[model samples]
Target: MVRTMNKCDETTVLNAIATCRFASASDAELLDAWTRDQLAEAFATLVNRYSVMVLSVCRRKCRCVSDAEDAYQTTFLLLAKNSAKIRHADRLAGWLHRVAQRSAVATLNRTAHMSEPDESLGEMVVIDNPLDEIAARHEAIILDEELAAMPERYRAVLVMQVYQGDPIETMAERFQTTVGTIRGRLQRGKKMLADRLRRRGVVPLIAISASMTTQVSSVEAASAASQLLGMLESSSIPPSPPLSESLLNPLLVNGRNLMSPWNLGCGAAIAGAIGVLLMGPAEGLVGASGGDTVDVVMAQKADADSEAAAVQFPAVKPADLSSVKTKQGSVAKVEKVDDPEVSELAIRLKGELDRVSDVSIDGTVESLADELQQQLGLPVLLDKRALAFAKLSPEQMLNFDSSQEPLRTSLRKLLDPLGMKATIENEGIVITANPSQLVHLGIGTDRWLSVDDETMRLFTEKLSESLKLQFIESPLRQVVSQLHESLGVNLMIDHRALDDIGVDDDFPVNYSLGGEVAAYDAIQMTLRSYDLELTVRNNVLLVTTMEGAEESLLSRIYWLEGLALDGNFDSLTQLIQTTIKPDQWEALGGRGTIGIGPGERPSIIVNQTYDIHRQIESLIDTLRSNSFHPQSKDTGAHKSTPARFGNPASGFGGGFGGGFGGAGGFMN
Candidate 1:
């Protein structure tokens, strides 16, 4: 979340919030939370800004008052639920109008499931005028529906003239068009709306069919919501949120000194809003309990769920995970049992691994493995992949002893004799027998990386930065530099690799992607045709060929233990190995190897290029998030699933174009 409140204070939010200080505070702008207080404040401003328009929309479509309240709450609560996905701040009205109407419909649908409906919630007016047989609220709903779909260029003019009460001449100045153009657009937009309403079999009301000759004021007597529809600053309103803040509140006046209790009450409301909206892993944890701390906890949980919903992973079958290798260096075996004893075995294993005590060892690799499992009570085994590389067998003798240290440290010492290390994978201990002969394994160095590295820490942040550009046949260097500028990363071209691959720095490129794309994926997408990939060295991003990346392999271990409990661990590793960079894994004639860890929660030891490692990290992080919040069937069409790159292919369907895409330029 952003922190726009940092620039201004409560005094500004309560008093002179009308000046240029907040002139550009769009709905998207106020959705950030650099600090917890900013999230509270920005959300408060958004609620106060849009409550009227949203309420009016809700009141129009929902027949029951309770349904209206539910719709209203859902509209705002969903806004807070998917705050990060609000890419179009200027069209906040359009977004709200659509969502508010959809929410009203959803609430009505939900009410249909009730044993009995409340008939007294709202009563429809029976007007006397023949031309106005339907209530004005009904008419507004029909017109608003048509207006929402119209191009902003045309519908915006109509809204300015009708809703905000801007004159034709004034609108021309704001739109940078002539008075005649404004009037023509206004008349044409109205006629189109009238035609649409007619096609829907909605009988004409003078308020809808009349041309520019009729003013919105003429229908004031017919509409119950007429005052709110037209240009009228509310004398007073409760501080709340919905849609159409700036669109309806053109003057932006009457900034109130929100009472101290307002924050407390709003905090409760905001907390309840999220609690009612989010599901999945956060199913029963959300609460409306009073406290700033609860707000932070609930909001953070919601944000994580939101991110989980944002990333999409392909479906994999459970059987696909069956028949893989079981705990350490055991031969490939089919795992076929529920094993009611799993919890007990897991506790025993944890106790063995966590024990900090003296230990001694002297035996063959087979004997060492046996000691780890049968004696120490750890579910230990060896990985054949690592052993195959090291050309070592379980019969090989090994020796080591330890004093008052973790069992894990002693296990490493035992494996250290040969170039292998131990990891917990596949619900047991996996002794990964990697080549210890090489001083550099593309790990924990400028050539390789660990999670502790600053660059590694910034991996998620840098990849999440959006990149959009439109250039026809631009030089490769120019495109690379442009991406560097957009992503704010230390991106550089690998000239040697480019030359070795017989590609030129000025290779003419004709590509256009006008939609949501993270910079990491964007780099891969633009360079895919040349067989290029990204790698890191000295904490700097390097663009190199897939061949260059393979020359110097790095090894990193991923603990997928708790992350993939919802699905098969082996299938997850297979998904990563096969799809992330299909050609690079050892199975595909490349240097990379993904060895399954043993335990209930699975893990994987990967030896690949750094860039590929980063991609794996993104995938696991996304999957972990989405596991908490499986997508909902109720709001399928309107669910906020913004494009966030996890798998390398997240950008596949996003390559749409009419103009330069903007994140910095819109498929989404």
Candidate 2:
């Protein structure tokens, strides 16, 4: 069979997958355009959205280029014809993926006799014949289907994190679980998936899953072009194929499946050549289905910026927590706040601290810490970082005779000289640098190298890479274009936001770097001159005017349920407002806002910048950790705790204290 049509440059497809913004149009938006059939670029935009994924599958399933091309076209054609019939827009990837799988299968069955087996080509590994290829493809498809059929919480977490590239933390919030739980579920879920694969006489294709996920996850949501024109083009497309098979899910995966039957016999040939891909190389080993012993093998560095062998994100073991923790601190928005409110628990804790105890610090501060923890009946943990900042150490002498003084007063006298303050978190009393002092720790120090936008993992990867950039007083457009080209990332500027800063395309940007610096810092440095901040909205990064990211606000509720059990939330709100970014508060003539959440247990709600928000979370958590609590192991759950929180925020309750809407936002 003679190959027809052009093969989309595999490199372009890969690059597009990594940094291409599906024209910043939602699948629904893109489909709407494709259905309208007005603009000449509609088909192009729609094709670009899933082209990488479709072609990836086609490349594996088809024996020859011509067959793969036909199959790829047929897959999109089905989407084009049935664009209007798609009900679940969010799962468009999943739906299209399944469709592509089937289309490839169907296309192969139709042309099985046309081509005489296959040889080596493209990025795929060599296969001796089509039969072996079929078996491997069979495993991958079965794996996909079985994975789809598993419990959603597990399946969702796996796919979103591993497959689609959503961060585990994002998945936690989406699934409303803890970070630990998300990781735990991934292990359990992977085990279950592996078991099913093994039961089917196939070794788990987890390595393949990981590799694929890593690749797709690297794709950033922010895309290329004029914001309006890009949107318009994405929504407009060429005529679609006749609406035949829309979303055909025989096993029913992802959102209200519309079942459709196929007339052709199930193809005997699977993409057997993909056995190399499915089985991987002779040397690579991802962790077992169990969680532990996950290895962090550095991937072979890409030969160039465009090398396919370059796995920027390889399947690292969960044991490689340093990177994950780094991301948690930088890549992900770290809400360091766990509000320790003033309530019955707080009062009890205060009482404990305030109790006059026969205690004396005659030895090292470590001895005093031990006595305090035992005497106050609260866990004593030291914040080493805070201790360092305060210029104190556990070995240092904190000599004091508090035989008649309250623990609170005694502890205060010892720490005051060191610029240390004690706060009660749910866990125990924590000795750390005073909050007033720590605020200075984060002030004017936000690099934002990794925080926000999971879809931008690849973009974030680019942002973190060191580059020697030089631009001599270039126009903003020129600056944006050059950076986009260098970083290979789509840079979308919010013109309206620029207008807020009285800046425009012609705004002169002077950025010069003689040495290699992270692109993230570089971009921030470039935009900082014009008071611009980056934000992700509608799955696209927006170069907003210096309102934060200033204007971008993420709201989180601090559940001080245990501490707030019997106290007014007002004071807690005040503590947060006064301590963290005081000037940023709306009450203090800043854009930030904080308030009491009206719930059975008092909850504090605040809207702030990712930076300040992180501070607030830290502040709350610190307070809760040091705060004292009265507890009984046999005590039943508290009725005061709201049901949604499910677990107690502290010692007193089972769920939420309460929550409110209209959270605060940030201004850069």
Q: In terms of TM-score, how similar is model 1 to the real structure?
A: 0.28
Total clashes, candidate 2?
A: 46
Which residue window of length 10 is worst by lDDT in model 2?
A: 659-668
Candidate 1 C-alpha lDDT tens digits along 1-668: 87665323433344234323443455445655411334444554555455555665666666655666666766665565555555544345455655666666566555254434344322333346735534455567766665554544445666555544557666555444345445545654565555566766676464443211212222221232222212112323223433334222221222111122223234455444333333324211212222221000000012222211112212223463233322433222222334332233332333344346565767876666677666554566655655655556767776677887666556655654575555432245555532212112322112123334556658658877776756687987888888777777788888876665356678665567888677777777766544567876566777776656666566666643213132234445556654564434544334578775332112467778877877777676565444433111111211212222122111111011100000000001
Model 2 ranges off by over 4 Å: 1-46, 111-113, 120-123, 126-166, 169-192, 205-255, 258-668
Prediction 2 global C-alpha lDDT: 0.47
> On residues 320-358, what C-alpha lDDT tens digit does candidate 2 reach at each position?
322212211322111221233323333234335434556
- Clashes in candidate 1: how many? 27
The C-alpha lDDT values of all candidates are 0.47, 0.47
CA RMSD, predictions in order = 21.2, 25.0
